[model samples]
Target: MEQGIIVTIDCETRTTREINLALREASLAQTPVRLSNPDCRHNLAVGVTTPLSVEIDGHVGYYCGGLCDGVDIRVAGDAGWGLAENLMGGRIAITGAAGSAAGATMRGGTVIVGGDAGARCGIAMKGGTLIVGGSVGVLSAFMMQKGVLIICGDAGEALGDSLYEGKIYVRGMIASLGSDAVISDLTDEDAAMLEAALGDAGIDARPEEFQKIVSGKKLYNFSTKEKEIWKTAL
Candidate 1:
């Protein structure tokens, strides 16, 4: 039962149900639908999504599309916290900006932010790819185990804390590192990955210009001096 729907944010239409109901009304039942005008709030669309293509026309609240799967999401404006958190699969794109912790602990899929992003974007990411065309705030991609975080602009402080097996790419500046993050040279494979992701996100760039951030291989056992040094290394 796939459907197509439209939603516009307002005061009376408070609940995310406004979006969901529109989808359902358009004959969507775990089906394909289109949504628009999700204002910044909380949990705009945060659960089982299927075969839907949501096109948000403005800013969105926290936890937008958190835990969504089998859907294609596109944002014409900015986003809030927990964007696509724990998403299993599918694709989400933001044309404007985002708030804190966008794509926190996401397990799979792809998220692209065209403009700047707030703090802790891609925090604890286990899998998938988070692409930001502009700067990101502090602690983005902290404790991530797998996947990739690619930023085309400047980065904030305290990134990749206790991260295990993921790759990060920043084309601009970094402010700080987390528990055991380190600066690394981008390998050929890493470059290929970056180019591929960027291409998918419709960003035109050179992979050779990007820098990769990796874990220090020492997840535990840290000294204050080392922490201080790492902090400065960012």
Candidate 2:
């Protein structure tokens, strides 16, 4: 492994503005950073484009690690809304629960949530992999264009609502299925894919336990007949 420089920031003692400046500086240098006392600040570590490792020791607010690419961020505690939103590349591991829209619109990357996530998890995701060890809330994966969403626990109502080209796997009970979203066959290839995703997230769950969800193809080509279903995407 390559040894990198370590930059530590004590959030409790420093202003959030100062902390963000230090974080940006370290990111520019491609150095590993340790952040303590996150204090629920929003937009921490957004837009990083370097290969860096960041360890956050406490809970964070909205948009943590958003728009990140080529970086790895690990949060030791719960995260607020939109964690890793619009991420392009890299990995974000959350050891605790996450708020709404976790991994929303992510194009590429891996986001692992160790606990339950709030509503709209993985919404509008164009590409990437999202693995949640616990449950997710309503409208999860709404309008997802492409990607993989794996839920090890129960999924809230309207799971995968209006899903377009994404693959959703839920291991537990689904309260309801979303419009244009239906249960699909879990093939051997899908099992292998789920296995790999679980392994990558360090989750010890059987792939066979999952149920797959995919677009119903009813709205794929979009005709007047599909108008009713298209409302679900909005």
Output the number of the TM-score-best candidate.
Answer: 2
On residues 167-190, what C-alpha lDDT tens digit does candidate 2 reach at each position? 999999999999999999999999
In model 2, the worst 10-residue window by lDDT is 1-10
Best by lDDT: 2
Provide the lDDT at 185 for model 1.
83
The CA-based lDDT of model 1 is what? 0.80
**Model 2 steric clash pairs:** none
Off by over 4 Å in 2: 1-4, 224-234
What digit string (tens of lDDT, one per residue) describes model 1 on residues 110-148? Answer: 999999999989988989889999999988888888998
* lDDT scores of the candidates, listed in order: 0.80, 0.91
